[model samples]
Target: MRIGFGIDFHQLVEGRDLWIGGVKIPHHKGSLGHSDADVLLHAICDALLGALALGDIGMHFPNTDPAYKGIDSKILLQRTYELIKARNYRVVNVDSSICLEAPKIKKYSDQMRSIIAGILEITGQEVSVKATTTETMGFVGREEGLVAYATVLLEPVKVI
Candidate 1:
């Protein structure tokens, strides 16, 4: 078994759509980035990539490339899946957490899990998502941004 971890953060800015865990939640502001800027998905993608010792998301999907301009993060996730599979690694499970200050995410947790699990080709139960606030302490507490963390377990193609 192999383990990998990843974390991502995005600043909230006006005139953007709020997308979390593949679900669009009603909010006044959204994360700012070259892509849809789904922080949760970004973290998950990094985790998967890291598990294989390949690299992080930015290495494979650079923000400077127009090909990924305003791209859907799900597509990036799919491509990451292909890369890991090419190396004969299979995702066993994933766990993640989101830290934000507004617009609670409890209701969308299940949907996020389902979407991520489906993309990773694992059971929904194999993916878990949790949410929390920063208690108004720092950037997240001040509603300036949101961050997410993800960890994944993977198994090689064949056992010893």
Candidate 2:
């Protein structure tokens, strides 16, 4: 089994829609980025890519590319998983955590898990999503932005 870990952060700004783990969340400010700025999904994608030593999301989906501008992060996640599948690797499970300061997200955990599982073609039970507050300590606590961390376990598609 191979273990991969990834983390992502995005600044929060007004006038953008907040998306996390493919779930559109209601919030005063949204993550700022070239894409829909779903930090959670981005982190997951990075983790999957890292598991295969394929580099990070930016290498595959460069922000300078207009094609990815304002795109949905869910699509990115799907494509990342496709790369993994092409290499004959399958995700055994994924665990993730989102850290923020405002607009509690406890209620959205299940939905996030479901969405992630669907995209990864795995069972919801194999995907775990969690949320936490920064306790007003740093950038996340100051409400400047949000961050997400993801770890994934991968195994060969077939035993050799």
Candidate 3:
């Protein structure tokens, strides 16, 4: 089995929509980025790529590329999974977490799990998502931005 870890952070802005793990959350501020800026999804994509040693998200989807402007993060996630499958590796499970100071996300955690699982073609039970605060420290604690971290376990696909 191969283990990979990834982390991503995005600044919060007033105009953008708050998207995490493919679920849109009602919030006053959203993550800022070249795309839809779903921090959780981005982190997961990075982890998947890392597991296969295929480089990080920025390498595959550069911010300078105009085609990615305002793109939905779910598409990026799908492409990343396709890369993993092409390498003959499949995700066994994934664990991820988000750091944010406001907008308690417990109610939406299950939905996020389902969305992520669907994109990865895995069972919901195989994906885990958690959220926490920074206790009034750093950018997350200050509500200036949010961060996400993901770890994944990958193994060769069984040809049963």
Model 3 bad stretches (over 4 Å): none
lDDT of candidate model 1 versus the reference: 0.92
**Candidate 3, 15-101: lDDT as tens digits:** 989999999999999999999999999999999999888999999999999999999999999999999999889899999999999
User: Quick one: how many clashes does candidate 2 have?
Assistant: 0
For candidate 2, the 10 contiguous residues with the lowest summed lDDT are: 101-110
The parts of candidate 1 lying over 4 Å away from their true place are none
Where is model 3 poorest over a 10-residue stretch in terms of lDDT? 84-93
TM-score of 3: 0.98
Candidate 2, 1-160: lDDT as tens digits: 8899999999999998999999999999999999999999999999999998999999999999999999999999999999999999999999999999988888988999999999998999999998999789999999999999999999999957
- 1 against 3, candidate with superior lDDT: 3
Name the lDDT value of residue 150 in candidate 2.
98
Candidate lDDT values, in order? 0.92, 0.95, 0.95
Per-prediction TM-score to the true structure, in the order listed? 0.97, 0.98, 0.98
State candidate 2's TM-score.
Answer: 0.98
For candidate 3, the lDDT comes to 0.95
Candidate 2: C-alpha lDDT: 0.95
Q: Write the per-residue lDDT of candidate 1 for residues 1-160, one digit (tens) a residue.
A: 8898989999999899988888888999999999999999999999998888889999999999999988989988889999988988899999999999998989889999999988999999999999999899999999999999999999987857
Cα deviation of 120, candidate 3, in Å: 0.7
